[model samples]
Target chain A: MKASPMVEIKNLKKWFPMKSGFKSKSNLKAVDGVDLHIYGGETLGLVGESGCGKTTIGRTLIKIYEPTDGEFLYRGGDSSEGGVDIFSLSESKMRPFRREIQMVFQDPYASLNPRITVHDIISEGLRVHSMGKSREERKSMIAGILEKVGLRPEYMYRYPHEFSGGQRQRIGIARSMILNPGLVICDEPVSALDVSVQAQVINLLEDLKHDFGLTYLFIAHDLAVVKHICDRISVMYLGRIVETAETDQLFDNPLHPYTSGLLSSIPVPNPHMRKIGKREIVKGDIPSPVDPPETCRFVKRCPRAFDRCCKESPSLREVSDGHFVSCFLYD
Target chain B: MPKFFYKRKLDEIEEKARPVHINSYRQLVWTKFKSHKLALFGAVVLIGVAFFTLLGPLFVEVGYEDMDFSNLFSPPLTEGHPFGTDELGHDVLVRVMYGGRISLFVGFASAVITTLIGTIVGLLSGFYGGIVDRLLMRFVDVMLSIPMFPILITLTLVFGSGIMNIILVLTVFGWMGVSRLVRGLVLSIRETEYVMSARAMGVRNGRIILRHVLPNVIPIVIVSATLNMSYAILAESSLSYLGLGIQPPMPSWGNMLQRAMNYILGTTTGTNPWWLTVFPGFFIFITVLNVNFLGDGLRDALDPKFVSES
Candidate 1:
């Protein structure tokens, strides 16, 4: 791993204000004070239940949804000194970085435009950036990228409707990869695919990451899928990250109760082994993010919650050589 | 027989193995449109009518105003009077052709103006979507709430009916529907993932609206414009029928119909000259009906969900 992080998010916050009454207002804190570092050439998996702000983190990083507060430091090539604070830059100033950070959307059907052909969809970024000199040159470039993404070059002329879900996803991957981005945010890329087709898309992503020397922030609810592709994994609850560690270390010795509960919920294939394995199912629905109490978010759901867990929120702290946890039990 | 069958089977396999031919967006729409038999028939009839009105006047010797005292009120199939003559000895054939030119021009010009205003308003209103949306929508509501026919009549009366003034009145009353349709479409399309993806690529707002958002709204605009053309033609006819549209000396399908009413009631020559009334009314009916069919075909063909079988 590189000595310095490629992207560092510090105290990131994204709150959506709601109109509770004519005069009264409340906020839904989708991502509240999230701090993360994504090193170059490593896949960092972000796993959480639905509406835990995993997708919000990814979107804010790409500036799709502007951060309410915080510094998003991005260290490009040769910028070892302090990096550029992406959140502070204006949109025009952020143009070059948009080419460097691309995203693979969750829904393949919705991501690709139906009116245009695959050639137009893939070449859109290139045209915006003025990467190719001529139309013919851009066509050849698109054809080449299509081949790289495991799609036939001839499919470039076809409309998006002609393709299956898996094929459309491959096209989405091609769209992001054509720019040769440094960080590719995969937001539930395979969650919408059939079980039989999920592994195929995951393998394609893994293969492309290796080929391009790309880093990824893989956001998914499936731990099994993330386990196969991620080097490190971060578990989040509500708007805060509860734990993060090396993939093997985090799986072997789960620090947070939430992490342990998540691992236990993954159904074992062996019928006999299921009886031996202990289940630690966390109780109750995830609390509403709107006007949440200023205490640990997991207190109500945590089976191991005690007095200290309710009185105050726990900040993420390094507990071992590399593993970090935010639970009061770790303290 | 076995050898011949074997050879044919091999050829069939080769044919099946060939690659699928890719069609562009335009080609797909064209193919889908071509398959609708009524639309195709309508398109052909419309094209013929347009050409006749536009070019037939150049070839005809008699002008619409030319009056023949000896041939006044002559019936059809008479010498040099295939469509016969009106009460004033004006050739009905020449007048109908000349009226077509005015009616078709008004329809097309008014449709173009309405589409332009509607699309711009809708794009700006939907894309910006805060104060702009509220203000524009309220204005559209105000415009829509006003009874259109009465306002059109009042405006035509005030403006003093000429071709330009009638078109201006029609355009003012006509654009609200298209603007409302386009605004509704744009509101949904603005939230679509493809549009978000385009914005994330750092494409400028203007470029995104034009390239990504506008293309999706185009099908609705096309359908609306076609409907508007028919509406404009009908409105002009009605206005002219009441003596508040394209004044006499200038032939329009509307005034010609009005002129034929005299012969129908036998107020002028005591003879019901069916040719005068039939020709002008027929042209108006044919043009409006065919234009509507073309619009219906376009709506189906341009739908993204529409799957062309082959």
Candidate 2:
């Protein structure tokens, strides 16, 4: 991999301040610390259960929520080497980068403005960036993108509510990709659609990814969906990345106990195979992110926890050529 | 999933060949609004009343202030007076028509002023959020706490009785409700993902509020403005009846009502001067009723939930 990565985030943290009058202020550490590197045209899957902070990572990386701590870097082209430190850039200075990095929100219903037409929704980015020469040129560009996203150009005139869930997701994808963004942060884009429509959207995304050389931070809770599209996978526990590796490698041999437990939870089609395969059942609820314990965040629910795991948290370390894990077992 | 792939390939080919059609949110809203029967009726009534008030006086031969002593105390269908004459022999029809102009002007002017101020305050407070929000909301609270009529009375006394002064008083107090209304709406709207998307697009704060937010809030603003008109008209009438708004020789509906009371009490020349009271009271009633109807219709038309339901 001689080509410089598109985005490199090191020890990224986003903490929300909870303070009201007389009560003492405390930070809710959503994305405590995450290190990730995404190559030019690969979909990096970020998997975690609800409230595990996968969404926050995507948002913080996009500068929607300012990074509380750490550095986010973006290398624009092949030879223009040294990556731009996005985390440190002022809002005005960050404008050009925002054009390169766009996001597709989860709920299609909530994401696209109901008051806006599909044409406006898809072309808003172009308008914001002041792209194209005229309205006619923009319309033609939008029409072409609409067709590529599996939506007819005619549908561009319609409002969001007029479209089906699958269609709305296609519109959302078009909106994000209209700028020909280098890196797109897909925040559970298909999670709100019906099960039947999910596969169509997923295929559309995959086709779009191949058609245009686009990188993505695909965040979702379902490992099954992530496996189909993501080349590399990063599993999150609480507010930290516990394990990361190539998709096939992560699936076959999960390094962290938390990752293994997550893999086991995915149901097998054959009942006989299900019984034969050992399922890891760990107990206890996920601890509160606000004032998290000093030990490993997943230690309470980890079946393989020991005395060392209870006292000191393990930072992520490269256990193999490409695989990284954050646990005492890896140490 | 495999079945979806096989089925969708054929649909995609056919779908792509289709021509584009133009549509817009404005068109959709207009279509939705047009379907509401009562809203259409209200619009018609409003237009009719406004037309009559604005231009009806041009066709009438009698002057509002022309006092014909020979026609004093004359009933309806008199030689020259069709609607009849008041105790002062003024044409009741002409006076009501003239009063409508003043009354409608005061209502609309005050409502427009109030809506503008309220919207600006709400946008500033709600979009900026922190201390600006607190300060503006507290001001609204303080404004709301003042007894409107009594303060208006005291202020009118200090300022002297005039049309502009009454409008100013109404506008000062009227804006609080609308500001609170707009602030509450903006608070919820600001949290929505569309607004977030706009921010992520690097749209300036002012542009976001104007383009993304203001359109969403316009329907509600319009509804409040229409309702505010009724409040303004009623307030002006009350002030005028109290001998404060649109003073003597000006012929406001409120001052007309004040003079009508004299006829009602048998203190004036006429034994029965019902036209003096009836026409002014009727015009006020009609104007307020139509405005309320328009407000109700606008509320239904503007409501997204209502549009979906229908």
Q: Return the top candidate by lDDT.
A: 1
- Per-residue lDDT of candidate 2, residues B25-65 (tens digit): 45545766788766677778778877887788899876777
Kindly give the stretch of ten consecutive residues in candidate 2 chain A with the minimal lDDT sum.
A275-284
Candidate 2: residue B247 lDDT (0-100): 78
lDDT of each: 0.86, 0.82
Instruction: Give the per-residue lDDT of model 2 (tens digit) for A1-331.
Output: 5266788899998999987589788888898988999998899999998998998898787777778999988987542678889989999998877778888889888887876678888778888888766776677777778778877766766678778878888888888788877888999988998888999989988888887778889999988899999999999989999999999999999989999899998988988778554889657777889878789999889889999999999999999978999999878
- Model 2 regions lying over 4 Å from their true place: A2-4, B1-37, B68-79, B146-154, B258-277, B292-310
Please give the distance, in angstroms, between residue B74's alpha carbon in candidate 2 and its true position after superposition: 5.2
DockQ of each: 0.24, 0.29
CAPRI-style docking class of model 2 based on DockQ? acceptable
| Highest DockQ against the true fold, candidate | 2
Give fnat for candidates 1, 2 and onward, in order.
0.34, 0.27
TM-score of only chain B in every candidate structure: 0.83, 0.82
